[model samples]
Target: MKNLRVLDLTSCVDLLVTPKFSGCKNLAILILERCSQLVEVDHSIGDLKCLISLNLKFCTELSMLPVEMGHLTALKELLMDGTKVEEIPISIGQFKQLEGPIATLPDSVGELIRLNHLSVRDCHRIRKLPNSIGNIGISLVELDVSGTGVSKFPNSIKYLQKLKVLRMDSCFFKEFPPDIGELTSLEEIHASWCRSLEGGIPSEIGKLHNLRILRLRHSTISSIPMEIHQLSNLQTLDLLHCDMIKELPRLPSSIRELHVDDELKSSEIWILDNLRLQRLSTSKLPAMIKLSNLQTRRLLHCNTIKEVPKLPSGMMDLRVGDELKSSKIWNLHDLRLELLSTFIIQEEIQLSDPDLVDYFAAP
Candidate 1:
């Protein structure tokens, strides 16, 4: 067993024992993914001096990791996603080469100077990061803390000079430390659901020229800084449920997907020109005289508009949350209407007109 190099026990639903793999002094990798019933890992696992990797993903019934895991000096990679493990042992920093998602690291985690990848998604109980987290300089490459309860990011994050991706979605941040713009090497960011955030986005954000994806959905932000257009490589901009936003800066031409709610005014509609817009939604249609190149539009909860307008020739899907009179709709193809009320339609007489048959066609 000393020669064991890899152990993969994924989806073994009823597994109940912590593997006694410490006997395999040469073990290099251990993978126990989706072992839902697994309850523990033996503390003696620290005896595997040559171990390089360990993965325990989606082991929901498991409650903790061996505190002695810190003694595995040769371990290089560790991954635990969707598990019930409560807190990361302080001894974790001893590994020197640890990687993957962490819930809450021991204050000693600062000692892991060689860590390169980390994701702490959905760890709702973690309120703050270790103050020493910033001292581990330049080694980390990816960090995602989305869906955690942490309200502020550790200033220590600025030390990760090699970081390529940082995702902090749903963390309830009221504002970010201004120095965040100093992470010049960052390539992507997901900061959705920061409901209390106010003021304009920091102008320094444009300095991350390498950024490719920015998701700020469900935030309270009312306007995007014109500097955002500097992200020449950005591909997706998701601003769903930003109810307070009234206008948008001209989007980057490189953007391929834009998902915004219908709270925008008519003047903002002109921003859609010359881009490959994919999904559009709003409470009311912009009063623009013409729309072309749009592919899909979903209108929700609009009380003012009485009819649909002449849409682009390539428009494929149109979903209306409320029914409109047949005559108010000028030309509709591939329409999907929901929650129609006869009383509402009768009040808007255009729908009952006999000539309406030429314009409305269901798909």
Candidate 2:
């Protein structure tokens, strides 16, 4: 099999140990996707110096990669999502074309000057990234480290001048590094669930001229810099559960989707002017209903909202909390009511509504 060029061993349910594929010296692509029972890749894999692509997606039972895997110098692409692999060997930095989701690369990973497109999603155990990662400079393209336990980004990240997309969702960073503005080529960023983040967002964030999407959900952010309005290319902004955020600056005219929490006060609602804005969530409906652009609005767990606000004639879908008084629902053209739990509706409402009979019937 030394001359074999492609080998796909995907979804082999009983496959436990890694197969001896190193004999395929000329192998260009090897895929082992959804092999849930796989435990480890054999060290002999290093002998496949001609391998270009390797995929190990959804191998939930996998624990680690072979330490000698770094010797596959000809490898170009690698994908390992939903695996238990804990540590990436430092020797991996020697691979000039390695790409894809890796939680923690070896400190020497900067040596892969030709590497591009790294995605490290749901790696909850990682605490930090290699400091030398910045050395890759303009060669790197996309970096996605969402759902990791990282608290801080390596300062070297600013050196990736060619980075286009950065997704750092659920990172526990208390604050973003000031140097983040240096990634001039960045186009999108997802930094949701950074609960401890404090201070206002850097005004310089608007400097990324190509930025299109910014997601900062479940963060402790108290205020957004007025400079945020400068992101002319911005299309979607998701700010769910930013409990301390007191107000919003005028949104960029290009924004189309805005998802916010239910607790925003009346004053904070004035800044929204997205003519195409479609999604909204709040504790109470506003007193002055003028949602000509609204398509979907969900009011969650707000007990005090006794009456639904007047919606625009164009409004299509409306979801209201269960606490509101029951009525023959004829007024709302496309209204959908989702009743809340007795505990969530309000502390005062003790009498359980018979419509809630479904809640107690759930398995």
Candidate 3:
């Protein structure tokens, strides 16, 4: 037992208590997933100095972890989701990764000052975060609360100055902290599927000079703050399925990917001057004069556009609906470029040239 390195007891529903691991000093991985009857873990589990991964997911009866867990200095990943565990031992602060569906996190969790990543995804019971989380300081690089019931962020979140990635997708939050701008190191924020989010994005987001990607897909936001144009380093912006957005604000020239819906067909979008755009999926086909660098274009559901604008020479993919395919200006040979990969047209639009069809059919 002392030499055992991996132990997987997954789906052991009858397991009531974990065996003492004092004799398995070299055990590096222990999985007790789906042990619905498990009520306690042996304190001797702390004796496995070489243990690196411990998974106790779906242990419905487990409510507490042995305090000696802090002794596992080499532990790196600990997953306890689907368990009844509510209060984690302060010893958990020694771990770098902690994920679960616990109701609340103990303030002692802040002791993990060196933790770089923390995820509580799908923890529907969690409504708020512990204020002590702010004490994690610059070491926290990414924080994910997606699929949780959390409706608000603790004001202390402003202290995560070094956080770079934040994923709150599918959460219940309606607004972001006004001090979100204080997170100067943030690079990506994915709040997609947050249908409850309204009141528009905080203009303070302009303070995120290093932000690279911002997605608010399926939200109820009626307008984007003009301050978003200040994100000079932003490269990707996705607002697809946001039917409430009536107009788009001027975007930065650095943007490479932009996705929007047909609701803005009549809205004036001044993106013709952005030369660096690489991918554009929109219902409005703007004039393409300075778009030599564009690679992909999806002009679907654009029944209002009468004529097809001159396309960029570097386009690699073009997908259009029946309206644009049947236009008098639609010519396959003129668009048959060297870089074109996928040219998707509606089935109703018949192909006149058999050679063009065969070229696309070539594997």
Candidate 4:
């Protein structure tokens, strides 16, 4: 039919193959999602020049797409989230309106100037992104490359004036482009668990006035950029398991939740005019004594104290890790203990490994 605007074959579990679309020149939307048995798509799909949206999600048996699909210049959105497709066709760059993804992307991906959102998460085989990716700077908003082996980011990323969210979790990038501060519109940047990234946060990062959440937990960076104090909208700062960092920097006034290593368990809490800092994990009890609104405190692997130090007056819950074995001095505080939310006690927690469990129980 010449006027076909939409063809929804969703949940066609037995559909083994799709018909050629050579005659449907005006077809705008074609959805074959959840077609469990679909093994292939006809190459004549390129004939549908008016096709704007094509969704082939969860088609496990389908692993490849006909290269002729690239001829659909009017294609705007392509969804292949749960498919077996290993690599994106190089010709796909012709679809300037393409938006998102799953396993792999082609170098031609940089040609999609209109792409707004791209997610190549858990695609371990993709070692690096093409320098051409910088071409999407004009309209690209969100880009996620978590769980890959990408070693570097394009210097052109700074050109993405409209970009907002960027997630690079569990990757091994050596260092971020220093001029990253040029992206003035960035909001949330989650690059946690990137243990191999060497350099600390770029000073330009503080220029992101709209940035709210910055999660760099479990990374190898040793120091925070002094410029971080300029993030006027930053709310959550996570630096957990950052063992190389020697000192914690004072944060912006807007910070509400602060997550760091056990090293800062005793540092002073910022007593600002608008103190939104709430929960913290520290080893020293002195940090907890000053904050009036501090709610939750975790004592992680703190082993030295003979007696539990005084906690914040308004503190609600306290979580104690696998440490503090003293059952004798647990009565250091004589105040109303029943009023606390979760009273932390000294005890040894069981490990997951069989040998480690027996080792902890020995003697």
Candidate 5:
């Protein structure tokens, strides 16, 4: 069919071979996704000069593509996730968007100078990226290698000055690229569930003036770099399940949310003498005598404290168990937080400001 522009045979499990597309000169989209038994794609696919999208997702047994495919100069998007393809063809640099399960990318990938987003998530065989990756750094905005075998980044990653978001969660990398701080335009970094990530964060990370959100949950990191306090634009920091950290450091003044939970038995110490904060959640209450800017606080499973520190006057919400009453840190009868809306405490303790009960009782 010379006029055929779109041909989608998604999930055709019995389709072991693709028919020659030599007659479909106008074909613009070809989708062969989820064809579990598909083993070969006819080389005549190159005859479709107008092809713009090609999807071979989940084609588990398809290990290779014909070199003739390089003739599809109009192709824009290519998806090969969950396929057995081990390497990308050097000609693949012609595409603007690509997602794959391939083991290695051709060095020609650097030729896609305009390519912005690249994802190789769950590609367990890819252990290293080509140094030529820096060739596309000028236009790349985001890169995701999450759930991949990439244990480290090439030194050339520092050349990605325009990169904004990076995600590598659930990876086994032991440390980050030492020059990670060079990505001055970065805004968010999600590295949670990196259980094997050890060796404290590089001090260069403090140089990211544009960084806003940083999450390193469930990691084995033992300490927070003192340089972290330099992140003036930081807003959210999550450290839940990070049992290895022994002491908390002074965080940025712009922080709005902080979640810290250590091991159930470790004597974790917190040195939270902050400038400004809105939300705080942790297992061991820190010495926040200076957290006057705090608005909300939640103490979870905290039964080891001997005394509770002074609560911020601006506190609007507080959630705690019977542990607070058991500690002799402050006089409950003198507590007069007027803005507290939610206070979950033992009925035996009464606050001096009777108005607090009215806010809590409000719908």
Candidate 6:
């Protein structure tokens, strides 16, 4: 009876603890996803030497892993995405095949060269990544240190040649490494909201030919290097709340989504023309009615918005600050408006149009 190969008990809401799987010698996959009440796993599960994937996502009650979890020699993928787990067993580094977060990444992490995806979101204690992390460059596909205390990255970071996604939002990284473009496989770089991060972006950013999305929103980035226009594949660029950036350079036509502050001059806004723009957010809406493909428009609060430009008739979503006084100047009765309450400005709005009411709060 020890031949169980796959065990899926996903969404077992009432289950508080994992049963022993020690006897399942051939077990390959064990999925306990969305088991909201699951608090802990029996350490004996470590005996499943052939186990490959263990998914425990959405187990909010789970705060710790069994100390013996590192013994799963053959386990490859371990997902605990939404759990409250604060720390992982460092012996996990001995897993050799382990992948992916918290206070401090053990230096032994270098031992798991099979590690691919690692995320340490909101771990305030970790000051830096283990220099040994560079050992898994060939297999590390994504690395995120968003909302952490990491003030600097190890020099070994330049070795992540195969990495695709690198997000360091709200971290302590004072100055971004200039050699980030060395990660030639990178497709997205989200480093927004780091108040301490103040500096001109490196021109080497242009070297990331594969980059597709770049967000430096609510940050102190002084200005976007002209080299940013070199990102031929970049489709989204967010610089909202960056008070230092006076105006954006002429962007590549590949841009489909752009978010900027209200201070941008009207003259500098028109240069983003006839591209693949699908959505745009700014203080004063741009006159890009020709972006027929544009579906979403978010206008920030601008006290001087005298008139609303003719927006796309096919627009699916329209978000404007409650302070927008030119409501009567725009024609929005025909479009389907979908706006979330969170994006709605905390103010009153007096609108008789039922269509607009769905997206705007009444005064």
Best by lDDT: 3
Q: Cα deviation of 291 in candidate 3 (Å)?
A: 6.5
Residue pairs with backbone atoms closer than 3 Å in model 4 (clashes)? 265-282, 265-283
lDDT of 1 by residue, 14-77 (tens): 8998667757878888889999999989877888878788888888887788878878888766
Question: Candidate 2 on 45-89: residue-level lDDT in tens?
Answer: 888888888888889988788878888888766777777776777
lDDT of 4: 0.71
Q: Name the candidate, 4 or 6, with the larger lDDT value.
A: 6
State the lDDT of candidate 5 residue by residue for 119-183, as single tens digits.
Answer: 77888788878888899899989888888888888888899989999988888889866798899
- Scored against the true structure, residue 170 in model 4 reaches a CA lDDT of 93
lDDT of 3 at 36: 93
- Residue 92, model 3: Cα distance from true site in angstroms: 2.1
Model 3 agreement with the true structure over 1-363: per-residue lDDT tens digits: 778999999999888999888888999999999999999999998888898999999898899889999888888888998888876776676777778877777787788888898888887788888899999976999999998888888889999988999999999888765788999999999989998886878899999999999988887766788888899999989888987788877778788777777556543555544335556566455443345566655554344455566665455566655555444455444344445533445555444556556766789
Q: Please report, in order, the local distance difference test score of every candidate based on alpha carbons.
A: 0.69, 0.70, 0.78, 0.71, 0.76, 0.74
Candidate 5 has an lDDT of 0.76
lDDT score, candidate 5, position 251: 75
Q: TM-score of each candidate?
A: 0.67, 0.68, 0.80, 0.69, 0.81, 0.67
1-363: candidate 6 lDDT, tens digit per residue: 498899999999999999987678789999999999999899888898898899888887988899888888887777767777767788876453322235656777887777787776766666888998889899889888888888888899889998999989998777877778788899999989878876888888889989999988888878777887788899988888888788777677788788776677556555654464456665455554344556665444334454565655566666655665443556554555654322433234344456666545444
lDDT leaderboard ranking = 3, 5, 6, 4, 2, 1
| Residue 267 shift from truth in candidate 6, angstroms | 2.8
- Candidate 1 has an lDDT of 0.69
Candidate 5 stretches with Cα past 4 Å from truth are 1-5, 23-28, 47-52, 73-76, 263-281, 287-289, 293-309, 314-340, 343-347, 353-363
- How well does candidate 3 match the true structure in TM-score terms? 0.80
